[model samples]
Target: MGQDTKYIVGVDLGGTNIVSLLMNKRGEVLERDARLTLAKEGRERTISQITGSVSAVLEKGRELGISPDSLLGVGIGSPGPLNTKKGVIHFAPNLPGWREVPLVEILTQKLSMPVFLENDANAAALGEWWKGAGRNTSNLVLFTLGTGIGGGIIIDGEVFHGAWDTAAEVGHIIIHEEGLLCNCGTRGCLEAYASATGVVRRTVKAIKEGRETILTDWVQNRLEDITCELVYKAAQKGDKLCSWIVEETARYLGVGIASIVNILNPEVVILAGGMIKAKDLLFKPVREYAKRYALKDAIEGVSIVPAELGDDAGAIGAAATVLKRKGLL
Candidate 1:
């Protein structure tokens, strides 16, 4: 390893998977490693998995003849409510036993490098802003629409972390006054209607209500087999039943995002996550509804696009934060 060689590590800590990356100054991903988070095993185990992944990426970099001895830092993208400045996860609903873990301090001690932390969604937004779909835009809003919706806001070039670090929670915005209950224990949240979980829930409810659908038969009457993807497939097959469900989901998302556009008027709205694979099926309704709901002047030329980085957004964004912090971006 050369003394002047510079590198940095990025970790995306998810409930199911932990991904690490070794990135160079030119923003090329030199090496990557991913492993199960095993979060249920407890905090120490999860952190160990993350650090091990980071080390594995670094080792892979070495195998590729990249002797980057001067590691700039390690950056972590974690599910929040987290104190980004203090580097503690106050509480992350996805990970059990992760209450107030001093992640930055612990990882720095373990890896012998400075560590920085950011909320995973915010990191993804930063990632998209730095190198993905939002590169051409200044004010951007991102929505990760999966099991639940995660939002990130970038105003100008910086993340909009509110006074309490809870800004840009676009998912929790109330769209329905008395709509479905959300996992957050709130009624009528955008997440309740827009998320993949919400799509499945709505499908199952329709099936139970005796609404005829191809999905019920496709899953062989096994309600659990119907997922958001299956719903999209069914819709693609021109199955009217599932098509309406997916359209309604997009409607929910569009209306939710409409609130964001009306309030902040971001230059671009990036929709990410597995659900985005639905492509036109998802974007069409979202755009239509958003245009209808948001102020015309607010959204005239705002681009609503899919995230380009996909799963890499979080990790890259985490690392990007380090560069951004050093003013190296």
Candidate 2:
């Protein structure tokens, strides 16, 4: 391979920040940079911010005596729903006023290089499959349990973009016909019960309803102070409410994964995101639930694992997007 094909820039764009990394085929990060997205500044300015961040990274590479042409191009992982076919962002709730922005074309024009766009969760799944926990597996599913739950399914080393390029939304899979109200106007979507927000909601409600717990001591009825991290900490201290909340959330996650296993039969299921940082307290229960609920045969050889890429999963996956877009995979 030539030098140009040896390196790529990965861009992870979020509502709050934009993280860029220069990486090689083996997943080595050579240089990294970050900037606040300031998305409220409006679409045009946000695009400019993205453009400038890429430019600055390229310039930094040049200053290190790296030839500009040696760069493969840029891979962008952004919040969706996006039009991957046309490289346009369909609608990103985090970024206000962002609608139908032709992100890929604009960046290509500005940088004079090819650009590839993908949903952040899908990109993260690809990233893990390529260089992280899901390595050596042809089929896999990834669930990111953070402020929200995002999902991606990788089948045969490729992201499964269903009709209209919006597939594998496991987070929205209805685990309960009549459960918690979801942000999507539905009842009991997995995300509505399994996300950090969901966990905190459950914890706070328990406290408000007079269920005994240590969480109340932290902030009495201050819902804003209730978070997954706080719940994890409380659970660590043996808080009954926090512990029960986690176990309940894990049950929903297990149900969601069981459905994915029954449908996709992937080789592995990857769990990533801030909430997973709870480690054994969260993971052990999730694995137990999956083993108990998932199809006996479908999960026979399946492995439930934690993601190795951590916070950089999206950025690295964005870089992988460049490779897949170029037909390198």
Candidate 3:
């Protein structure tokens, strides 16, 4: 692929879904498809699912004047603890069957195209840096606050993958020492207090403690059906308990981000994920607390913003990885 290369493929691999996009160098997605990851079906089956989705998207692209051979390459953003240099998913806590899977090598061999891979959060950061909120800056940090908190750092205009490809595991930042048990078997990690699961856990714990709130009624006294969305809605309706839950989560989130600022001092912090849809409910407290904790010199000129690419960030970033490797981005 050269400067004039017109098409590339982006694949976003998640615990629950696999989304593929056929896109041009200009960032316009010409075709797309998404399906259940079914990772439990094991490594080979998941790989087949991903390749099938990519083929479907390419078929759609074929309808748009681009032939199969016209494609430049394929890029993927996958759940980590992986080695980008080796193109392997070292391990994914949420992906049951994934352990040291040589994903990029397999995909490259099967697709017969140059294939690139990065952690999904890192890919989202690259996507945002290339085409979304971080577009104007050379240094940026992106924290994806979703099922789990995932982060990526861009320094001097490039993704910093670190020596062992494990540099930016921001979610594992320990905040409260032994405060709460995390999915990773650690205590008091930022993910325990800020993710969707964390939010729900906090709310349920509050309800269990006999704290009076609208969430109790909203969930019909059943904690199993409670969600972060339900809690946010209750907060919006003036529920003090729910509001406190969100505000407190934001504070923990802010502390985690402030630590990043103190260390990396990136241009901006981009917060992404479904929970961020609450907008000010989450951003306001995070800024307030982050400002209180981060260094005056380090936090200066740094701003917090939500991701602009929405759900397409993964796919776009996946493509951007290939483009960057090819010196086209």
Q: Which numbered prediction scores highest in lDDT against the true structure?
A: 3
- lDDT of all the models against the reference? 0.89, 0.87, 0.89
Q: How close is candidate 2 to the true structure, as a TM-score?
A: 0.96
Query: After superposition, which runs of candidate 1 have C-alpha atoms over 4 Å from their true positions?
Result: 1-5, 64-68
Position 49, candidate 2: lDDT: 83
lDDT of 2 by residue, 1-329 (tens): 46445778899999998988887766777778889898989988888888888887777877777677778789999998998889999899999998888999999998898899999999999989988999999999999987778998999989999988889788899998899999889998998999988988888788778898777678775767887898999998998888888898888898899888999999999999888778899888888898889889997888888999988888999998988888876
lDDT per residue (tens digit) for residues 133-239 in model 1: 99967899999998889899999889899998888888899988787888878799988888889888998998899888888888899999889899999999998
Model 3, span 1-329: residue lDDT tens: 55555789999998889999998888888899999888888887889999999999988887877888878899999988888888988888768878889988899889888898888888999999999999989999998887788898999889998998887889899999988999889899999999899999999998899899987787788889999888888898889999999889989988998999999989999999998889998888899899989998998888899999999898899989888888987
TM-score of each: 0.95, 0.96, 0.95
What C-alpha root-mean-square deviation, in Å, does candidate 3 show against the real structure? 1.6
How accurate locally is residue 222 in candidate 2, as Cα lDDT from 0 to 100?
70
Lowest summed-lDDT stretch of 10 residues in model 3? Answer: 1-10
- By lDDT, the better pick of 1 and 3 is 3
